[model samples]
Target: MAAAKEGRKAPSRKSAAEEQLPGIEDARTAFAPALSGALERPRSMLRALRFRPPQLLHLEGGEAADRVALALWWAALLNCDDPEVMEPRASAMGPCLSCSSCLRLGVNMHPDLILLDGREGSIKIDDVRGLRSILGEKPHFSRWRVIIAAEAQALGIEAANSLLKVLEDPCPDTCFVFTAPQRERLLPTLVSRGWVVTLPWPEAGRPLAEELRPWEQALGRFVSEGRGWLDMTAARNGMDAAKAHQILLIGQKALADCLAGREGGMLAAVFRRMPAQALMQVDELFVECQDQLQAQVSPLLVLDSMAARLHILARR
Candidate 1:
């Protein structure tokens, strides 16, 4: 993506027509419960700002769209002029959607809200430098300047390091928010600098597939019945990187479902028998496999490696 132009307001990546379309407003109602739950930490931090507040906030584990919406909601709350009017019980409960700050943020026009979107392309070093320049100035219209880097996993290494420098010595009254499929997708050093808020996986949008049954059953047996059931050769044959990644995701969802106590599936039944720590290890393995895939590792090698490691876990 191109670097944001220098000014109080970084030029919006969205076209005028796209900005006019309903976004965070619709997301607020559609994802009310999830948004409310995710906002609790940031809300508390905002209430205790006299103490050290996290300069960087990582919103992880949700649909990318939902993460962005939650970030926007948090931004609104931070800048809202009348949060007390909407949330009478607690002044910091949430944003008053009608406040001037909230209104501009709702439509992505807030000058203090700078968005460095990496969804369409890699966020480059120039983008981070441009953002640094803008952040050097004070908030143009609100108590806080919020920078939302949506799909931050797409930030190139150089750009991520550049942003990391900003995070290390963050501008006063500035907050940096990052949204990603998982915090593991970001550099560990970068993730360490932020406060991570994990959003629940949206129930209706969790990836599902009828074709996943066979794979799920296979995984269940491999875990339940031991290494004899794992056929790495067969698993690797004819599989491409995309399909391998899908299988890992499917496995992850099953493990997550089992942990959440959502019942009645083959994988869930098998996963439920394992200790919670073992289940977590399996999930971490899936993430590691995904990282390898993203690094252009061969699908066969990744699958075979995953199978061997899973078999060792199954034995435990």
Candidate 2:
């Protein structure tokens, strides 16, 4: 299930197209050479879609949301019953997003679209165990099965090895797509199995408070003041930790960028107001909170603890 149904009501949803990063529009141009060669052969359109591209496709760069949106778009394209709506609409149409098949993809409920996320920031061995059985069956609706691993770098040692086994002997009708901050961060074994496409984060330059959602800006203020504002309301509002995690990572990166004398991202000023030691401690605490949540800690309790911890971190 997507974050919404996981009882962690996500703050907002960014559809695949809405999440496109800087170079997404020029997508085919980047893959033009390979696409040209692939199209040179006069194969049936269905055959081309199902069996043409390499089974493994890695989407590199951009924020996690951007990558996810891209992955979803790719998955939708692969399974769209009507290929006429694709790339070259006149030549190859993209998915009619309104169709039943496409709708399922939008909702993250397509039987053939398997979404594997790192529950607590790590993709453990058990997470990969079910892939085998899921792949064993034929796709329930679409012509091809698509498996998207949102944060491929989060795969643990054993999980990566397990994934490698399947890659070594992949199911013919399935496509494996991975999204990550950097391709180099992935296991070499995984990297060697596929080509990579890099998507840099969208050009970022905004005040930290402005970069975040209005609520996040408010949260930042509360954090800066060593106050508790997100204790109960976040859960009531269905906040998704993944989104928070992204912000935390961005904030940390901003701090690093500031340190290196580079123009930092939106949250740079926020970090500027924070002490280095306190920021480090807060970062570590967030990781711990995520891990505990994965370990079945009560959501309310976990959040309360986070609020208390943030208050202390801010005080320092």
Candidate 3:
């Protein structure tokens, strides 16, 4: 028997009888606004998935729980039985909250849904092997079998290689969803095989570590005073690729917060002074710096180049 139909009661007509899965509601609420704003691109991509679903879907960024909630919504929509829910009407923008499949997912009682929580521990080769038998079978009640691997960065090398092979040749009507803080954290081979979606950071904003405060302050000064404020010699001495990466990450977050009209101290205040277009350019610069660092560029060189570019933008 397929996992979907076994060890679960038949679908009930009264959706109210089911209780929501723990933490799902809060996760949903946290990401709700972003779905329409920061997450709109991913949401649009979901429409395409409805026609030809990808074998592997990788959602990078955002809180792990929030990503899971979005994945659940996708699963619910793919399997929803309500006829009226098929249209793209405003009223039908998301999963039909009252349908049997939606209800089943709400409470996490759906037989077709498999959740591999990496937070528990490392995902081993054994865990990947266990899913083979389940994937071979057809979905019992829904149109698609959804396997959500939350915090997929925890997957060990063997497990990632095992899962990568599965992604190369996926079973019919099955989708594997992986969530992590960033795609760079996952195996390059695995990342290459999936349809990757970049979600926004949560609206609440991620707090920067206290140790990063000096770097943050330096960023503010550089933005406000242009290249004159930067000390290339000191930066070269004090910065490594890892530290540079963290600084860029912090800058990206502050820029995002500024765009969202959130008050985020000095960094945000500096970002706010720039026009939206300039801020976007800064965001792109940060991404470029990250890519350059990944490609083994000298951290000091990248920082100097970034400072030069920001100086021009600050003048504009």
Tell me the whole-model lDDT of each prediction, alpha carbons only.
0.69, 0.59, 0.70
Q: Report the CA-based lDDT of candidate 2 relative to the real structure.
A: 0.59
Instruction: Give all TM-scores, in the order shown.
Output: 0.57, 0.57, 0.56
Residue-wise C-alpha lDDT for candidate 3, range 1-316, written one tens digit per residue: 0123212232333334334333545434533543556566777777656646677888887766667767777777677767544544533366665665776665567778887777555567898999998888877777778888877866767788889888767487688889887898788998887888878756566677798777777777776776443564264575655556666767787887898788886778877888879988898998788777655476678877877787678778
Q: For residue 237, give model 2's deviation from the true position in Å.
A: 18
Model 3: per-residue Cα lDDT at residue 140: 75
Instruction: List ranges where model 2 is wrong by over 4 Å.
Output: 1-51, 83-92, 119-121, 206-248, 259-316
Report the C-alpha displacement of residue 280, candidate 3, in angstroms: 26
Error of 2 at 169 (Å): 0.9
Candidate with the larger TM-score of 1 and 2: 1
> What is every candidate's alpha-carbon RMSD to the true fold?
8.1, 11.8, 9.7
| 139-165: candidate 2 lDDT, tens digit per residue | 665666788887776676778889999
Residue by residue across 52-169, what tens digits does model 1's lDDT show? 3368888887566678877787777666766352333564466666655676776677778888876545567898999867777877667678898987876767788888888777
